[model samples]
Structures are given as structure tokens and as C-alpha cells.
Target: MKNFTRVLLAALLVASFAATAQDEESPALSISGSVDAYYRVNLNGTNDERTGGTIAPGTSFANKTGFALGMANLIVGLDGEKTGFVADLAFGPRGTDAVFGSTTASSSIVNQLYAYWNVSDAVTLTVGNFNTFLGYEVISPTANFNYSTSYMFSYGPFSHSGLKADMAFGDFSVMLGVFNPTDLTDFNPTGRYLGGVQLGYGGVYLNFLFDDDFFQADLTAGWDLGESFYLGVNATTASDSFYGGALYLQNSFSDDFSLGLRGEYFSDQGVGAITFEENVIDLTLSANYSIGNLTIIPEIRTDIYSADEVIEDADGIDVSGDPINPTYGSNLSSFTIAAVYAF
Candidate 1:
């Protein structure tokens, strides 16, 4: 027993020394990441998904009843007081392509890889692939509050590759980037990364991206009304390729209980100049009660689509209204309820 204890101590000492050596070799490097999983059944789909049972659409339970859909990210960063660098890797099931044997479109591997070097307290330069500055929500599900993404979030400019820079002072920062267009497979462009900027101060933020083929602009702001009530508003307008934006408000009466309501209006111009008008107003409310390690979350949501929004023909699908192969514009009104847990 004494010999075993000595051996264990020696192993621990070696690990400590290795870690020290690593720290000395890269004094600025740090690693951090997060994983999130949820079981969600969409009641808006069909009876097959909404069957009333344990984790059904309308039940209250600790475990969500659905497939394990989630996201994970690993961020490797380096810092040296005023200067810093970051590389992020993203992966999950929701974004995989069905042709690759995935239920949904989830890409595999390090899709988002970028490096930024801070040159001064007020400015920094970045290169590689990164997310575009355009939405209220992001691609990372672990960082989002809702299980399903909004219409605006699904169709916005995703990312860019090339030279980017950010300037910061006080509570406001301005970012500008140029990227190469890589079609649908990637965010960076083949010749340029496009060009974009975000300007914000206090509770408000605005972003703009302009390219030879397209231009996009978004305005967003949030107000925290005292203890638990807050209001958030955002709007987006883009040239023919994308259409999505929402204005909403959220409130929390207590630590374990909260509610949210939002009104959304959207429209999209698909690839090759096919246009679809989308206007909708959605109402969603959710309640959560926590007990120790278990949390009971019940949510209710409703959506109403505008009359002029549905399309009868789309080239991507052979006759758009056909249910056998409906495109993204076929259904405008859909609702969902889910219960989730964290372990």
C-alpha cells in the first residue's frame, strides 16, 4: 500500500510538471468549452412526433422526449494584456446534411476557425472563417435560450473569410471585415470575404455587410427594466438573397419563473432571385420550476402566417406545394412545446 501511494504521488507530480511546462511554453494560451443537449419533439410536425407520452409535446417532465440534438464548442485563446488571439471550433447534429446520413443538416469538423491579433487597445485584426454580424441569436445552441431557431436566424449571412478588424473604446465597438464568397458550402468568398461592420453603444447595436452581389443591415437594442423585465427589438433588411428579422420582449417575475412574447415579420429571396413574401406574428410563453437537480419546463407557442406569403412554385423542389418534397416556404405557421434538462 505504501509503494502504491508513492507511485501515485509520483505520477501526479509528473502531470503537474507537464502542465507547468505547457504554461511556460505558451503563457498566453487558455482553453474553454461547453456542451448542451436537449430532447425535443416537434408537435407542429405530425402525430408521429406529438404522441402524448412521457416527453411528448404537451407533457411536463424532467427529461425531454425527442432525439438528442445539441451543440458543442471548443475555444482556444491566447492573451497578453492588450493583445490576444482566439480559435473556435463548432460541431453538432442540427446542422448536418441529410445526404450524409444525418436526420438534419449538421456539419462535422472544425467549420469555424479564425485567428485574431490585437494590435492596440482600440483595434484588432482577424483572419480566417467567422460568423457574420447580423442577428439577435447565434449559431451556437448552447448559448441560445430557445430550442428552435427563428426565421431570421436560419437565413442570415452565416460567416466570412479574409481580413477583419475591430475597434473598441468604452462601451462601443466597431467591426469591419472583408470575405471571399464560397457559395453555399462555406462562409468565405472565393475572391473576397465581402465587407461588414457593427457599431454599438450601451443597450443598442447595429450591423451592416455590403458586397458587390448583396447588402445586409440590422438594428438591435435591448432595455432592462429593473429587476427581471426586459425588452429587446431587432430588425433586418437584405438584398435579394436573405430575409429574416424579429422584435420581442422578455420578462422574469421570479428566479424560477419567466415569460416572453414576440411579434415577427419575415420575407425571403431564395437562390437565383426567387422571391417569397413572409409575414408572421408569433406568441410564445414558457414556465420553469426547479427542484434540486431536476427542472420542470413547460412551454407553449403559436404562429400565424400572412396570406400572401405561401409560394406555389419553387425551382429547388419539383412544384413547391407538393407535400412529398416541400421547400422551406411551404409551412409558415408551426408551433412547438418542449421540456429540457441539464446534467
Candidate 2:
């Protein structure tokens, strides 16, 4: 940790010197941000009222049946001719959990704080904390197609702190870095390092990441069939125990309205003492309506489980241990409505 801190400080000093020597005019600072909120409901009656808990299928942000605060974000940035810095901060439930791994009041609040020096037209160096280069979906609600999330995106690494060098060759660009462990948001480093690479060509992108205990490779492709139709896909795998993928399609009827559909499949290889593995498939359909700066999303999702494990009741009894909850059951459903305002 100490060595990492020393390296970061030295990098900052070098960036300041280069900026001062390269440009004489002052750079203007910029600000931008977004806010979001949502409501959710489980249609399968999966709520355990005795415990005030609900088990919604797949990965969901608004887990409860009432209105909820999603997040409010603020970003401040400055750019010189050859140097730049960004400070992104967030507040509310989703943002807090993304940084601290929980919704606790006392925790780190900074999402990303990084400084970069453009070495040349094709090379750049960046240091400090930044978003992970591993997934297609982001933590912010305003960037996702559906209001709810997927199992793969929810379990993947969210952010990292490191020093990276990027080089570009026309349509191809690559980035490599080394630094702390996976989800450490605080300044306490783990003395470990991670490596990441991104390769892109027009509409197709591939990402690779590796660490001591985990390795992930993902691919995303987007195509515009016409002015009113689009297609997208994401396939990802992590370690030896998990793999998942999703297909997305959208149709635009007008400038103010559109609809999207997403279908996904996920599998788990299981763990010790657990005799059964899990295979699940889900489908989601959503609509987007734009009104100036605010966009509203109404989404419905359904999940189908391939195996019959056990379902516990409110008192923690295995209601499905002997086929009691429902002799043959394998489906769950949910709905959510979200509003996001970006500026």
C-alpha cells in the first residue's frame, strides 16, 4: 500500500510539471451529473412478510414494492491541452452500495478520482481510481437499457484503483494496468494487482481481465439495421464456475418512444456439499419514453429455473423440500418503473 501511494504521488507531480510546461492558457472546469428513482413489485408473491424480506428473481435494484431513491450523481472535471482530471461523486442507495459494497451511511463516497497525462496523440497515462473495464452494463441507471439488472453484471467487479497506459492504432486500442484488489474503494490497498485489456473495431468490442483468483472475458456487439431498429449482445464468463450471456433488441417508433427486449441465460457449477447446480433463463421487455431531459422506463421481467432445489418459508422451513409450495413450479416474475434525469 505504501509503495502504491508513493507511486501515485510521484505521477501527480510529473503530470503537474508537464501540464505547466505544455500549455500557457488556463483550462476551464466542467460539471455534469444525473439523478434516478424507481419502484418495483414481485408478481410471484415471493415476499416473506414475517421477515420483511422479498426474494426477487434475478438481479434487481428496486427490491421492494414502494418508491425508492436510486441515486444522485455529480461529476467535476478539468482538461488542459495535454492533461486532465475527473472527480465523480454519488449519493443515495445504488451509488452508496456501488462504492462501499453496502448501503451504510459511514463509508467512502467517491466513485472515481483520476488524473491523466496525454503523452502523445496515440498514448496516454492515467492513475488513481476508475471504473472497471469488465462489463457491458454500468452502475448508473441512466446508462442501462432496462431498469433492472442481470445476474452477471451484478456479480462482476465494479471498480478498481491503478495506474494504466493506453495506446491506440486507428480503430484498435489497448489498455494495461496494475494495482489493488477487486472491490477495494478505500485507500487501504491489498498489495495485489490486476490486468485489463480492451479491443474494439467499429461496433464490436472485446474485454479481458485477470487477477490471482479470477479471470473474465467478455464481448459486446451492436448493429444498426436501420434508422428505427437495433441489435446488441453480450457474452461473459468468469472463473470456472459461472457463465452467462444476453441478447438485446430494440425498435424505435418515433423520436419520443421506443421498446426493448432482452433474453439471458446463466449457469452455476455448484460448490461443495451442495449436490444440485443451478441453470436459469430470464426475459425482459421494457419501454422508453423521452420527455426533454427525463427518460422513463417501465420494465417487466420473468425468470425460469431449471432445477427444483428447496424453497424456504417465512419461518425458514423448507416448504418445497417435499414438493409442498407447489408440486411443479419453476417461474417468477417482476415489474419496475424508473425515471432518470441527466444533464
Q: Count of backbone clashes for each model? A: 15, 0
Give the TM-scores of the predictions, in the order they appear. Answer: 0.67, 0.83
lDDT of 1 by residue, 1-343 (tens): 2343234335433433333222223446688765545544434433232122121211111123454544456778786543445676555553331012112234344445655554567876666566666777666543444445555655555555555667788998887555455213344223333556689899688988665667778988888887888777778877765565576677777777666665566654553211223354545554545454334444555544454434222222235333343223333233344333333
lDDT of 2 by residue, 233-291 (tens): 88988785577899889999999899999898877664211123377787989999999
Residue 65, candidate 1: Cα error in Å is 9.4
- Candidate No. with top lDDT: 2
lDDT of 1 at 251: 74
Off by over 4 Å in 1: 1-25, 42-45, 49-65, 95-107, 182-189, 241-244, 269-277, 287-298, 307-343
